[model samples]
Structures are given as structure tokens and as C-alpha cells.
Target: MNAVSAALDDKAIATGPAGPLLGDADFQYLRAFVLEHCGIALGDHKHQLVQGRLLRRLRALGLSSFTGYCELLRRDPHSELGELASAISTNVTSFFREMHHYDLLVDELLPRWLHEKRREGDRLRIWSAGCSTGEEPYALAMVLAEAIEQSGSKVDARILATDLSPQALETARRGEYSLERLAGISAERCRRWMLRGEGEYEGLACVHPRLRELVTIEPLNLLHPWPMSGPFDAIFCRNVVIYFDQPTKQRLFRRYAELLPVGGYLFLGHSESLHGVNDQFELIGRTVHRKIAE
Candidate 1:
């Protein structure tokens, strides 16, 4: 289950004094809307949980009840879709959350890619599909910047960090984090890449401009159509697909395959897999799949 779902599960399954109750019709409508627009499946037992979580959204929008929210959705689904997704989902991520993935890039992939791409003078792209805040892309940038600097190669390289939540994307754009959030990073890397703040911002650290330069943050809903067309070298979509149902997962992996060239890589969350979803990629490492010629 996703963080929001887990949070709801942790609760007593009671609405309590949380604004208004979510009626059956409105709850069903929300389930369908979420399933269609967000690709997340809401179970029958999730009624009370959805009610409890969405109360905050209702309060924010000055909505009196679930029926009003449903009506607003009916009038204009696009306007509030991202906010709805934000309310119902949780962004549980941290710097180098999965160290093994980084180890693979730093140890083997980056050197080889830099060498080959330098020879070919080709642009290298990596997409962080659900970059919650800035951590994933910035962490990626650290290694990527190190690789480029070490190889002395200026192969046009960039990391695309996209998330559906506006709030999350804004945090990513800021590229600043609390010092406590830097625990996942090593002390040497912290000294090298993070700029510590003083005075009013004493507890915070901002990403170096080089890391910010290498990362481009954008807002993108995966269920919606995409604007870019390209062969990315690798895609990190970790911990984002646990909410998606079977068909959604199938279509998403297929689209990822379309954007990745032969031998490109797809890095999934440790708990996620493409075993029955798609056959375009072969598993090469823990939760890492490489695209194969069909």
C-alpha cells in the first residue's frame, strides 16, 4: 500500500469529527475518477479511509461535503486532479533511498556510458518519473556530475525529474532540504555537493548550482499524455507504481520501453516488478531491468 493508504489504515477507520462524511455515490465516483485519471485502485474497504484523508482537501477548497467535491470534479476534473492525487497519495522518499541502485550507476554504468557516449558525442538522458521532492534527481546529479568530471567528458547529459504533485515539484525546484534530511548522504558528499546555510536558514542545506543545473524539474501526470519524445538512457520510477493496477502498470511499462532505446535501463522500487506486466525488459539486477531487442 502507498503511504496515504497506510496512514489511513493506521487510523481507527472512523471519520470522527472530520468535516463531512463521504457518501456512497460520491465515494464511488471518486474511486472511478481516481482509477481513470490517476491509475490508482481504491478498494471497497477504503471508503472510511478515503473519507478521512479527503477531509483536508475539502477544508482547503471550502467544500462543505463530498458531494460538492464530486460536483466540482464533474465540472472540471483537470483543475483539481493533481491536488486530489496529492491528497490521496504520499511522497515518501529520501536521498539515495535505494543505495544499490546508485552503486550500480557509480560502479559500472556511469563509466561505461560516459566512455561510449563521449566517443559517440551523444546526449544522455535519465528520467526520474516520480521524483517526489528533489532528493532522487539531486542524488542522481551528484553521481552524474562526478562521472562527467571524472571522465572529463562533456557528453550532453541531463536528468528529467517529474512529479504529479505541484507541491512536490515546487520543493524539487527549490532544491533545498533540512540537514536532518541529509542523513542518507555521506559526509564527504555532503561537504562536496551541499551548501550549508547560516543565520535564519541555519538548519538547511541547498543543492549546489551544478546539481541544480543538471536536473530539470517538471510536473507530469503519468496517466496523462507526455510531451517529450526521446530515447532516455535510464528511467528511475521507484516506489511510484505500487498504487497502480495491472493494466495501468502494463501501459506505463510499455510507454517507458518506447522512450528507452535498446539496452537502456528501467529502475523500479524494490517492492515493484514487471514480471507479468511487460516483457520488453529483462531483469539484470535487484529491481533493475534492461531493455532488450524484441
Candidate 2:
């Protein structure tokens, strides 16, 4: 690799120390803070992750240490807490992530749903729950746009991409992506949905304006009253439920069930499920479930 490239990579990864922050008490404080503020039931495994993600932010803010920062978060009750939550929130997503789901949506699932929805004013709605940095929803929008054009179907599709992280939402709104993040994108998909960066934007890809207009990025804590009314057709809530305790997951899934219609689809992360928490949804596939409207 070039010397300049290696240096930039170093800077990116140099955001924190290589291990958990000092003190078990400090670790416990953050665990409590995350649970109290964001409703994410963190445990011993995430100690290093929380410390790593927060080290740069805390240092940048000139907080004396993790102890002081935790104190600030404890006392403050405003957007700052949300900002801290966002900083520590997990976001390991990419374009067309977990290809099977997207393929199913495109090849078999969406066609049927679109056929049905076309009668009801040609509208379709999708929610990308816990959408980090916008890739998943944007990627979905691009696929839907392509599907619409290909099928010559005048379907009005909208995707609500929500995250508790404003910082991630800001990045989502900007829609500029580093080359590394673009790896998962297929060449054809890239050509269609992305504008390759050049000049000042070298080694980056920007979501085309046409596609950008399709997704509405919003700062949303799932714990909030859901501010959205839906008989949504499908909800892509991958990789988030594992963070919550059983009761919280049950409540959240119940809320999701209420928001969606009978036969509505719910997608979870590969490692997550509604097995113990929710019985209202019928598990149809491996990690995919259909909300059984009771």
C-alpha cells in the first residue's frame, strides 16, 4: 500500500486504545448508562466495543476520562445523551448486506407485495430499523427503483430508515461512502445507484440524487412512541434485537406487530430471533418471520 494510504488507515483505526477502558466500576457505569438511556441490554462481551467506539469521541470532546464522561452523561438530559448513545451504538452494515434477503425481496417477495399494493394507490412502505449510516435502506431503495423501472410498474415506494444515532444519520443524509464500504455493492448496482466520486471526492461513492430522494433518514430511538403510523408492508430490522433483554424485545416486537399488517414481513439479524420474546409472529424462514395478525 502507498505510504499516504497506510497513514490514513492508521488514523481511522487509531480512535482508541486496544483494550477495555480501566476499572470495572467504570465499565459497569457505561453498561448501566447504555441500558438506562438507550434500552440496549449490554453485557460483558461489549465492554471492549463500548470503550473502543467512545474513546475517540470522549477524547475529542476533551473529557478528562471515561469516569468524567460517564458522569456528564449521568447528569445531562438532552441531545448530548442521544449523541453519546449514537457514538457507542453498533453499526456494521453494508450495501445489499446478506444477499439472500435482498434476493428474496426482489425475486419472489416484493413482486407479490407490489402486485397487491398496486391496487391500493400503488404505494409501498418499508422501514429499515436500526439503519446505520444509511447503506441498507439506500441499497433497498435502489433495488426497488430498479425493480420499478424493470417491471414498468408505477409503484410508489418509500423506505423509512431510522437509527438512534444522529451522527450515523448525518452520514446517511450526506450519502458519501468510502471505497471500502462500497465493496459489497455489485458492479451493476453500483453503476445504477451510485455516482463514482472524483476530484475532491476521490475514492468515494455518492448515492445518486434520484435514489437519495426515495429514503427519508430520521433520528429515532426505538424506545420512543414510534412517531410513525403504519400498516407497513415489510420491516427490515436486522441485527438489533439481540441488544435488548427478553421483556424489552417482547415489548418492541409487539409494537412492531402493531405497526405492521397481517402477513407483513419482519427481518432480523442472522443471530437474532423472536423465538422466546414474541409468539405473535410466525417464523417462516431461518431468520425471517411474518407477523400473524391475530
Candidate 3:
């Protein structure tokens, strides 16, 4: 038995009714399944993490064991796959989590992109790949809106926000959040771009219709074939690649390179790096890359 399975087997046998235990075999099966379907490589050490995350699903479905859950996935792979992905993956995000990327977007990228679009009369497109719960795309919209207002440019721009989690995408489509989620946004921006909830909806805020109009949220699994064609000016795929294995990261980065033109920007998570993975992009800022070659 693998380490994770061995560790959990005894606990699972002992802990009856407290929760359904994730067995060794089940963990291995799930590890491989998640890697194959979502490009997320769960390590042996993550067995406990997986068990904890999936426990709620077990209860929700009235499942008695992890094996039963696995069987359910096997029985209906198409419908249940998304639920498995939602349960296993992490979706921790906040508005303007990485502030500097937006700063760079407003200061450098938008101006150049807008200028080019103006000359060609083409609309601007940005891909917020792995956008979770709307923060990243909304953040992009806010910055782009501010840039357009300041420059007095009649630039038509849109953000295509995608995520593997359908639940997260639902929340993103709603474009509503509790007041706590609106922290760190400036008062002027809050007033201009967000609707302050009142009365029964106190302590809630929603993205203004104008801002929401600039973004389109969709369900997309990065591991699967992408349908939309893109030569996006910039792509924000931050904090996402860290979950994948090395080869998966390499392939994903190469795909991102293919989607961007020379000088197009690609933003990554602060902790992620392109070093030794793909050299098509050059380091332009902290955790930001500019596609330098084909």
C-alpha cells in the first residue's frame, strides 16, 4: 500500500460514523483521476487534504464510504466530474490579491494595446484563465475601465474569464459579494464600480452592470481542449500552475505562449516561475512575462 493509503486505512477502519474514510486504493485512484482530468497532481501527502475536502460531498450524497463516491464517479463520469473537481481544487481568491499586476496593466500594457486596437479598429481581448469567483476578471475590468476613462480612449475591451469549477463560475456570474470581500478597494472605486447593498442586503456589494458587462464568465477545464480561438493581448493565469506537475506546467505555458503574440503579456502567480519550464517569455516584472518569441 502507498503511504497515504496505509496511513488512512487504519484510521478509516477505526473511525466509524465520524466520517467516511478515504482508503489507500481510493486515494490512489483519485490521485490519478484528478491528474488525468484536471492536470492537478495531488501528492501522497495530500491524502488527508483530499479526504477532508471530499468528506462533505460524501455526506451530501449520503455515501457511506469513499469507494462508493469513486464508484459514483465511474458510473457517471460526465456529470460527476465537475463536482469532483470543485471539491478537490482550491479556490482561494480576493479582489486585487496581486495589486502590482493591475498597476502594470494600467501603466504599460493597456496603453500600447489600446493604441494598436485603435489603429486597426479591433476590440481588445484578455483571458483570465483560471479565474476563480470573479475577483481576477473584475479586477482586470476595473483597471481597464480606469485606464480607458483616464486616457479618454474609445477602446472596446472584453475579458474572457474561465474556471474549472462550475460553482465558482456561478458565483462569478452573479457578481455579488459580501462587504468583507470588498476590502482593499478604494472608496472612489467602490462608489463608481460597485453597487452598495442596502436594507435586507446589508453588508453586500455587487459589481456595477457596466463593469460586469466587460467580463464574460465560462466553465473551462484547462486540461481539456479549448474551444475559443485567441490572440489575447494579455492573459492572467496566476496562482494556478502551482498545482500541476512539471510537465503539465510546461505544456500549459507553451500553450499560453502560442495564444499570445510577440510582446503580449502573461501574468503568473507570485510564487510561480517560467525558469527552466519555457523560455518563450521574458521576465518583464515581478511574476510577469512578455512573450518575446514565437
The best candidate in terms of TM-score: 1
Query: Which candidate has the highest lDDT of all?
Result: 1
* Candidate 3: 10-residue stretch with minimal lDDT: 1-10
Better of 2 and 3 by lDDT: 3
Clash statistics: count for each candidate? 0, 0, 1
Off by over 4 Å in 2: 1-26, 44-49
Off by over 4 Å in 3: 1-17
Task: Give the per-residue lDDT digits (tens) of candidate 3, residues 1-294.
Answer: 332233334444524466766889989999988888878899889999999999888777766578777777777766767778888888889988888988888777888777766743577889999998998899889988877777667777899999988788899999999988988687888888889889998888999888888998888888888898888888999989989999999999999988998988899999999999999999978999999999
True lDDT of residue 148, candidate 1? 97
Q: What is the C-alpha RMSD, rounded to one decimal, of candidate 3?
A: 4.7
The CA-based lDDT of model 3 is what? 0.85
Error of 3 at 102 (Å): 0.9
- TM-score for each candidate, following the candidate numbering: 0.93, 0.86, 0.92
Tell me the deviation in Å of residue 281 in model 1.
0.9
Residue 159 lDDT in model 1? 98
Give RMSD to native, each candidate: 6.0, 7.4, 4.7
Q: How do these models rank on TM-score, best leading?
A: 1, 3, 2
Residues 72-108 of candidate 2 have per-residue lDDT tens digits of 6666745466677776666788888888888888887
Each model's lDDT comes to 0.90, 0.79, 0.85
